[model samples]
Target: MRAFHNTVLRFAACIAMMLLASFVPAAALAQEKTSALMTPELLEKVRRANNECFACHSEEGVKKPPRADLDITKLRPLAHDPKVFNGSNHGLMECTQCHGQGYTEFPHAADARESISACEECHAAKVLRIEKQLDASVHATRVKDKFTCSTCHDPHVDLIASTLIDPRKIVAQDNQHCLDCHDSELEFAKFAPDDEQTSTKKKRPDIDKIHEWLPNTRVHWQAVRCVECHTPATKTLSHEIVNKEKAERQCLTCHSASSSLTTRLYRHLAKEEQERLGFANSVILASSYVLGATRHPWLDRLIVGAFAAMLLGLLIHGLARIVARIVRRKKNHG
Candidate 1:
């Protein structure tokens, strides 16, 4: 019996050793595969390749997009397409946005595949941090649909549109975008807008209208831009060595009148100014207060309709008061 027990124990040990041996080769194969696909040197090559691709594609275009309204058929650098270089917008993104990955080596394009990192990537934290402070602190918390860094701020080229193109304007789109995502606006009746961004954009669509109309507006109001006031929260701004360098504010600092934000805001100017100021939160409030105003989307119709009714009521009251005065004046003259 003792001899039989020793034999059995030896057999069990052999089986365990065989199993361990089997796993070793498999693990080695896996490691070899990973090493084959990726390496520090290879990654550097990819990065360098990507930068070259972007340079010509973005700064110099071979074939300009028709929608961009810029003709570049004769443009050189056929190897580089500027659209491909303008940073990734998500390939599924759009013609203008250039699908977010920018360009990759045609053969190795798989590396640019969208991942969870795309959503939880560096930009994500940036947006969330700003919003968190916005909710708790003075920054504008309300954000619009599809609220993203790309939404209010563009990452691609160094720009602040210098022309008055409708799409470039920030007024109708900007502050309203801020109001859309703000938690306080939805939960509370109104938010006390403060942060440099929110405070700067406290007025709707464009502040230029106020400044333009003011008699001494140009001189009294220093022109401002979004970047001037809302720089990276951590990286503080300093214009001059004077007075310890006051925080930069106003559009003129970096943005000429032609900045993209200014231009986009200008387009919405043609639209009704007062209504656009009705951000998602204010729209919600309008729904609560007004009646027979909305007949469209559940929230939109209700909110917009309420505000419209109030505006209509005020117009009617003003007209009625004017008519009454006219009638009284006629009676006195007769």
Candidate 2:
């Protein structure tokens, strides 16, 4: 019996060791990949170079330009928060790397502006994927040549949404990109001009009035991203922005057990939740309370058990009362 128990213990120990061995490599590989992307030494070098550029291109720097005659609007495009840039995915890159060595001068050369590298230059693979999706989008089809990557994404401050853990933060950032164009009349006119001279120009719709049909519009806006409805429901993090006419209008798209949010707004969290909690829609419960959707299997079981117990207690109480009443009647008769 002792020998048999010892053998079982050894087998369990081997299984535990194998599991630990498997996990260690995976964790190490992830760490290795992150370090390969940007080491501390490289990050420091990038920051130093970026700080020098920011000395002249930052908000305060842009206000007091080398040339007083320089239009603030022209300088505004160059202005960006240094702290925000450092926190972004592109934080490891130097300014001159994209803008060219011409910017090394006190006042950048006029020709240097033309040398600024396109987003496609560095992000070739990503751009290729986005281009395919963009080709099918309303922006590309309607605006044609006028619309580009920078139209929605401000490269200076843009962060990779998938890497972010917080769903609310991701929604806030992504929605802001949409609102920047849709909400502002000046920005809206850029793509959809309402000029009477150009009869072909698209008229801007009243954004708030259009969304009046949605219940608790403010809550919906805060909790979910615009892309949840605007983009294709079939794809995850799809760039294909659909027209208002084709946009999702059904409330059940989100307010259900199998919510479309699992594939859209909360996609980053959904996969993690599935791995951690064995529930994909668990992401929704963590972030926001979606009616008819936030149900957990264990929680539902507990609720049912409680209700059953309550009914059983009521039945017992009723039986005891009837028994006592019969005894009292018997005593009275005696």
Question: Best-fitting candidate, measured by lDDT?
Answer: 2
Candidate 2 residue-wise lDDT, 1-334, digit = tens: 8535544554454444334333432223221212343456765776788787876678977877656665678678778898777655454456765676457786678787766667766566778998988999988877867888888887777765554557787778888998997898788888884455777667677878889988998899899989888887776577899977888898898988888888787776665665225443777778788986776667778899999999999999999999999999999999
Evaluated against the true structure, the overall lDDT of model 2 is 0.72
Task: Name the regions of candidate 2 deviating beyond 4 angstroms.
Answer: 1-41, 64-73, 193-200, 274-280, 298-334
Clashes of each: 38, 0
TM-score of 2: 0.73
Q: Which candidate's TM-score is highest?
A: 2
Candidate-wise lDDT, in order:
0.36, 0.72
Q: TM-scores of the models, in the given order?
A: 0.26, 0.73
